[model samples]
Target: MPARPHSPCVEAAPNGSFFHPDVKEAFMNAVTTEIPALAHDAGVPPAPPEAHRTADELRDIPLKRLVASPYNVRRVPPTGIKELALNIWKVGLLQNLIVHPMKVGARKAQTFGAAAGERRRLALIYLFEHDYIPADHPVRCRVVPVEDAVLLSATENEMREPMHPADACDAYRILVEAGRSIEEIADLYGVHPKTVQRRLKLARVSPKLVDLFRTGEVKLDQMQALALSDSHDEQEAAWFDAEPYNRDAHAIRRRFVRDEQSFVSNRVAKFVGVEAFEAAGGAVRRDLFSAAEDAWYRDHALMLRLATEQLEALGASVLAEGWAWVKAMPERDHATRSQFRPVLPRRTEPTDEVAKELAAIDQRLAEIAAQWEADDMDDEVAERLELEEGALSMRQDEIEGSLLVYHPDDMAQAGALLSLDANGEPVIERGLVAREPVAAATTESGENGDDDDDDSSDGRPARVAAPAVKPTKGPHSERLMLRLNAHRTAAVAAALAQQPHVAHAALVHRLLAGEYGHSTEASALDVTFRDHSHNLTKHAPELDDDLAFTMRREQRRVWGGVIPNDSDALLRWLIEQTDERLLLILAQYVAASVDSVRPDERPHAINALIPALGLNLADAWQPTKAGYFDHVSKDRIVDVVSAAVSPSDAMRVAKLKKGDAATEAERLIAGRGWLPEHFAKAEVVRMKLWDVPAKASDAEASADEAEADEPALAVSADDVRDDAAVAEGEGMPPRD
Candidate 1:
């Protein structure tokens, strides 16, 4: 037989340690244990949730007759009682109190214990004490048995949930508008002052954002971030007036404080010092809501004025260097900047100590380089070495420049510029020579007469809108074209390397047009003579099969092995070679300069060069799964299959998945000599390089513009791609 459980004992009344359970006057029933009789194996069913209170009778009990139940579940310090009192006073109690008769000496007692709603009972007492309600104010009560009182109280307290954060904020806002101070509200709710402030902050946010918060469009944290701004107009502007990319919590905070003067981290503010700016009558506002509490500077014009005055003082000090002029420019105009040529100082002999320092730096740099000999290095080590090298190089440059001075003649002909750098340090640029028209560009020794190296500071005023991320490109990315173009460039160079005649014409045409003032004319050969072989290597990847690139590399390898290593020895060897062998090597170098990387379309001049060398790009390259099929869209792969194979084959490939389709297309296009559209289109050109018994005598002396712009064609090779890249941000600087 199972033993029966002991009956539960109830503790007497409750809180500041509110609601003491050990009060002597409170009533609680005595505990008793009873054994149950054995049953015939039929199990009893469970009772409904509200079964304990279903039989209780509703009664209009006077407020004075109700007492807090010792069996009430909540025992915390009395909280929200004042608000509860105010609500009951204004609207009357909406919920009935759960209570039981407290039998005294076997007689019905006038007072009943409130098993639930102890807080409500307290609130009624509060209103009566304050004269807001009568002592015998009628209160609704559900009278239950004394034995069932604790269960009903526990259920009511445990089942309720607190209000939402947004609602709480609005509640606080209501109290504030009703003439309650923040401290009063904090004391009223037993919360801290900052809690009230934060709640009120949300309440004060843009009403549109408030609507967003209510509708779940804006989150609580986002609303809190927005509340940092005080003005409704500014808040709306920060949210709505901002760029689409800039409409986020972090960006909204930045846009609200758009005034340049108040930013404590501004370069000008940092340069002048926040204390100094404030002393100079600049207003500073501290954003307490910000995590870091960063300040904003309010005086834009004042900061600029102070920066200019300080620059003038700095410039005046530099005038002692005997410069022809020293100008202090808060903002250097382009017209003023254009007047002078940039100059790097000439270094004189360094002192013994500086020489040792330079040697130490060189030794360290060599050590790092030696350590970096491995094909792959640790990322941490690489990053550390990069930082170390940068610092060491900067120090080395400073030490090397320490011995530099302007020549007295140069100083007489030049001026110095004084302005602030990005960090707001006053930087002085000395030895800026005025641009002068000269009879010759070279000295008697054939050395360069100019000394310009063209380096300048990123000079600008404070304040910029938050930066936005660049939108992503389509599937046919620039990277794909860059790789393809790199291969094309390599092919053109390799082909040109074999054709010295084409190289000769291009070089001669460029030199004649540049030197002799044929400015108005365009050339069929618009090629520059700068080496971009490194750029070609940099942009292309997976180039083990680029035939022209491989061939050019092999040719370089062969020459590199055959040529004399020493410059003087090489010169002598070059002089000894027959004109044929020498022209071949020289033409190889000239051909390497032929960069024809246009992104999608070929230049009109390059169009002329294509046929000149009998260059066949189709022979040089072919599409493979990895190279072409994988990168293109499914539709494009199908199109390729249709073009290279048959429409039926394309339809079959299209039925397969993307990856499988690409594989099938690669298989179908393998033996077909079909090329992509970019490669298949080319215009025929005609060129007449050398004159043959022209009617005019000057025609022998000079080539005409008509001959250069539109030349007669060489051997034709059709179906070659013209998909080279636009210049990679660098071409020869326009001679203009």
Candidate 2:
């Protein structure tokens, strides 16, 4: 076929250099049949010029090396050093560092350092810090005279790739400090004069951010933007957070210095169809001082113009109407959040009745689906084959009408033949063949025609014979399985519903209620809880006497606990208790129980329970419980706390319990000679209900009796029945 391929061989080139198969192959294919000397020439980019340092003289250098150089110039920057470090880590360093000689009292001595690859130098330093290499290992470095140091450093930094912006800035700083003009630095670095100037501007940035820029944490644009801030403090603060700093480096020097913005206006302005500088200026003007009426007017006019143009383009009548409404709105007026345009045409809310009916329909559909699945295989097969309800019903009608068309025998034969074909290759007829008609016999003759002896001897229709049925083959129909799964779900649900506890929970009634509940409430009220424990003993009936006693005692408590017809002291005690213990209990219940209810139900439930819990305290107390104060009093409950308290002390409570609301008379008078006196009198009318007692105790008997004793004891109803009943007696009226 083809000449056998030669076995591969490897050898050094004839030039006695690096050995490689590709090089050898290329050598064989050369124009003159000689390995080209230029093969390696086009190979690797020159390994950077050998670093001229003493470290280079060492035969075995540590994997990572760091040495200071006398030739170091801050103007030179790291270039391919980061890449060189990565390469050395992966392939091992093949080159040495460069250093320059220093004179100590005229005796020349070499000091080790890196000439090029500042990034590599840092990376090696990182390795040393990270303990990647042994601390004491010596490294190879190349040495040169002190005069060649600057050249070496510059060549090392500049020979490969490019310097980062911060590095470039560093280099420029070195040159400037050395008496080189910005122009001269620009020419040497192959940068524009402005570039050099901009770098110098970067050099003025705070040291923290300058270092961040050096490490590339902050981009050049971000640094430029930070520099543009009008105040150094502001720029430093913004830079500390790495706020969205962006500035056009190419921006005019005057504008860059004057701008205070952190974002590059031009970049975003381009998206909105304007120059960024102008956009930024406009934004600052609009945002900074639109408070004065004149400023507001000017800004409003510009906004109106732009808005008007936008609306005109929409051209829809609805939009125009909306715009008209917006324009007609008053300026600076605050409206309650509830006031809003209607979202839809007003219609009476849906009645609960209709929702119940829809839910019932859903349940019925679930029931029907379940019934179909529980159907027999024959029915299931018919279903799988998609035997429609109407079709199946019609077939049954046809079967009852007469057994002329299909007989059990014919189906059995067809099934057997189908089975034979499935198991092995049954020779099916190549051409269609008509089956012979059965004799003058009963329907049974059509099926299993081989069973001739079972037929009537007279060959007439036999009343006793019926066609044989075939067994269902293969997997059951999917329709049947689906119906079965549905039935199973329903059966389980029904069984769960029928459980004893389900009955105790009135589950069926609840389920029915839920049918109505979902439509009315939009959620089912019935809930199923998994049982983790069972009742150990059957519930026992209480003895009649015990039961009666229990009911009577509960009744007595309920009535006794009612807000008692009491003297003013008793009423005050009750009110205070409601503000404290009763209120807290009610609150805990509301927080736990009421909150568990649906959102719509919660408001209604709370409203119904509010009066029952005696929480209709004057609006003054609402702030104490729901707003800011844990405890508030008449005058002390001002918008701001009027005084501080030590834990062990009791202070006079201020009478202005109604918080910031100025008293009605005081608000009306505004200023009057009698105002302070009237305010003092009003404070006296507000009481400290918290001082009232809840129940009698040895320490609280007088308070409790004063609070809970009947007002009837203080007044004779016959003496002044009508007026006495009007006010609970404390020299006023008898309690109801």
Candidate 3:
């Protein structure tokens, strides 16, 4: 690659530099090459034999005329339509869509059904609808008869073999070596430059590993893993060191990342900014193959120490603000803070000047709201108006909120928490009062017999004293418990989705087992599941790194890759899936919809499957100062500590300040297999059957799982025969 003018996108790399100079040169060379063959390799049908038609036969047909055909056999929707659309929009369509003349009503204009290239036609339509392309965007197409069109469509999807990964990588390498640029190759192949870069890297893996891939001894994923490292020796070492059965793609990747902290995902690393770490002389390793959201931080201790120092500095400032104490914790999850009481700000009315500003802002907001209700507005105009309204409303709120300040007495009693937030910025939680002694619990809410009823609800005693009632009941108010329940429910749903057998069992129990003889509705199934991702994320943002969250994310990715976009195609495609595959996805969807997050009740039905699903809430969640203990009474923390550790340990922590007790409880509870009592599995003697040996039936019902495949769905040929009628109504003329 020759020198070029600077580009800001170039500075976005993890290491603040683009690829190696050699890789840059290769990308430059690949960019210059024609990519017609690459596009053909990627699902576009090859040109027909010249003997069938002249060059004139291949014509530019309007996109609207190139409608989808019913006879196009590939029912499964291909993934990446938006990506494909963007590529076509940028470089124009490469391959001709195989279209056939369709029979239509006498009054209707002539049109063609795209039998072979439905995906490309859809891409063109997407572009046109988005105004990226003209209203009548011309799609390059080959005119064929009805029977030939069907044959071409089926053959292009089924008969044409995709280029082998090994061959494709080698081809990319050759192009790069022959002075082609990545942009040119990406444009020709309808892919991102990074994709070409990935292929080139794959080609550069240990030649021996490439040979293994060629011989089918190594899989494509495994090859991709080995390509993570540039050193051929390191790649070979990783390959040789792996035990045969353990040599999966993830395993290979783990071998490389074993010692390094996942900086992107690790909260502490985010808290200690990347540049700060580097300035502190810490080493960072950027993975060139992956999207650089975060790189491998080489020194874990250094990262932690850096975070601690920053937090400590922030604590000093908080303490100076007259807080009784300032606690600086490294973790972003402040679950333990649930036990602490929050001191209310003294809400003396705003000053005259601030009050005037607030009134003016509120008046403007009312005017904007009235205008919004009265007028039908353009999207841009509405957006602009909405923004102005939001700004005014925010200004009003700011003025009012500023009046509610920490009173001198409240600050004298309450401490502050100086720690990292989710985004890694240091934030100080003010007016935090550690739980007062048990004697003070009745009046410790700082209300002094105040107006708000909810204020009196704070810091209810977690448990009774030496008489020792079961400590599971927490001191949290109903509303806060509901929030916790929402998070837990989301986690359970995620867990349930991963275990198809358990999900199936839950379904069966709900529909049959519970109805027949079971006394309790302990199955957790409401007989329906809905994707509550949006709701759950809004309620519990901390669930972002949760195992359940990750599992659901992966599930979405997997489904997106194979499922067709068309509803008709989806039905056909689903009908075609294997029993196991169908059951797996069914379990995921069903599990996702499960919601037992209620403060009034424990998740008994959902918890019953804990052992069966091997659901570990401990792994998914941790008690933190802010997230858990802060919302509950200090006694709850002590109760948990006692149950998880010992009575002596609980007593020891009980003597400390509520915040300190919570922090201590978190430490004691770590790796103790203790979760919030609501998550505990309930004892169940369920599923009484109407017939068969009672003991045998009960034993079978209680068994961990039945791996039996779901019965195959039988689709009558009659169902498919009517597809042509359905196709006709959906833009396609009567191609049959």
- Per-model RMSD to reference: 20.6, 35.4, 27.1
For model 1 the local lDDT of residue 453 reads 22
lDDT of 3 by residue, 1-736 (tens): 9898876534433322233345444543543243324333444444334322432257888877776665565668877778889887767787888876665556876677677888888888888888887867777888764434444565577777888888998999999899989998887667889889888888899889999998999998888778767789889988886567557775677667666777786778888877898999987755556656447777888887888888888788778888899877776443556557666665566678887887788788778878888556889989899899888877865665566667798788889877665566676777878775555423212323532333113332111111111225546766666667667667678777777887887787677533332223334665546455545554565765465575685555446434665789899999998888788888887776676555543324455555566656676677776577767788888888888899998887776667666656776787776766555533332222232222357557444123111222222222434534854764411111
> Each model's TM-score, in the order given?
0.36, 0.22, 0.37
lDDT of 3 at 141: 89
**Candidate 2: lDDT of 503?**
27
lDDT (tens digit, per residue) of candidate 2 on 82-180: 444445555565665655432223353322445444455666665566666565455555544333444555556556687676776777888899999
Residue 553 miss distance in model 1 (angstroms): 32
RMSD of model 2, in Å? Answer: 35.4
**Which 10-residue window in model 3 sums to the lowest lDDT?**
460-469
Best-fitting candidate, scored by lDDT? 3
Name model 2 segments beyond 4 Å from true: 1-167, 170-228, 231-343, 346-705, 708-736
Q: Could you tally the backbone clashes for each prediction?
A: 29, 32, 34
- Model 2 is weakest, by summed lDDT over 10 consecutive residues, at 532-541
Ordering by TM-score: 3, 1, 2
Cα lDDT for residue 75, candidate 1: 59
Q: How does each model score on lDDT?
A: 0.63, 0.35, 0.66
Q: What is the lDDT of candidate 2?
A: 0.35
What is the clash tally of candidate 2? 32
